[model samples]
Target: MRIEHLAFNVTAPFEMADWYVAHLGMQIVKRGETGCFLSDKSGMLLELYEDAAAPALDGFSFPPATFHLAFAVDEVENLLRALVKGGGRQEGTLRTLPSGDRLAFVRDPWGFPLQLVSRAGATP
Candidate 1:
């Protein structure tokens, strides 16, 4: 079966949703008092739920070090810059793979690691 959607437990659902919209170009498909669903128009969806009582955890604990979300972008550098302008922080420098693909990592406002991959010469 094909994948459907990914969900994130965020401290501020609306803010996180807005972050995705502003930085990643995701559009809000649905919204509720406690959560929101965003779509990138490519059959991929993201769900953000508010967690007001979430406990604070040390790094590499709650989310686990291996958990992360990746998104394909038309331009990795532009997206990385936009993410920083939108309050997200870049984790490290961009890298070009052997296949000539470029990738970069960034953390959302609440510290969710996200990978920005370049889809150069591909339609958005």
Candidate 2:
């Protein structure tokens, strides 16, 4: 079967969803009372679910750390600047690989790690 979408738990679904839309230019494919479904111009989907019950997904959890999500980006610098301006913290520096691809790790306002990736030869 083909992978359809990814759903992530966050404290504020709308706020985090809008932040992604604003930063990465993804469209809001669908909106619900508890979360939002987002897709890029190519239609890859991500779901943001509001879960106030628990925020941390450390090793002491069920979902586990391997379930983390990442969003593709064109230019990591601009996105990092925008996120910083909007109160998001930089979890790590620009991690550049030998292939010319780069990635920047950042945490949303609610403390969820959001990975922004840019591959080699990718247009941003």
Candidate 3:
């Protein structure tokens, strides 16, 4: 079976949905008062749940040891610039792998780590 969707407990679901749409080119598949579902052109889905009571866990403040989401882009540097322009923060420097792939890490508006990688010859 293939992966369906990744869920995030965010403080502002609608804002997060808009951020993804504006920056990552995701579209809203469904929206509700407490949550929203978004999908990319390839049908990859993301679920965002609004949890006002959710504990604040900024990467720098709390340091989450959990998983991070990685997205493949045509160019890592361009995506990094887009992410910063869209209000996301670049956490670290961009690195090039020995395989000639580039990787950059950034934190979403709500502080979730996201890896942007060059999709030169990589397959889904």
On lDDT, the candidate that comes out on top is: 3
In terms of TM-score, the best-performing candidate is 3
Every candidate's CA RMSD: 3.0, 3.8, 2.5
CA shift of 94, model 2, Å = 1.2
> Candidate 2: how many backbone clashes?
1
lDDT of 2 by residue, 15-99 (tens): 8789878866788989999899999887889898876786723322323134445767888888888987887778657889999
Residue-wise C-alpha lDDT for candidate 3, range 1-124, written one tens digit per residue: 9989978777777887899888988899999888899998889889988676876334445332255678888888888998998888887689898888888888888888888888558853
**Poorest stretch of ten by lDDT in candidate 3:** 56-65
Off by over 4 Å in 1: 51-65, 119-124
Between which residue pairs do clashes occur in model 3? none
Name model 3 segments beyond 4 Å from true. 52-66
How many clashing pairs does model 1 include? 0
Superior candidate under TM-score, 1 versus 3: 3
Q: What is the alpha-carbon lDDT for the whole of candidate 3?
A: 0.81
Write one digit per residue (lDDT tens) for candidate 1, span 32-122. 9889999987868888887668753222343423667888887889888988888888887899988778888888878888888876556
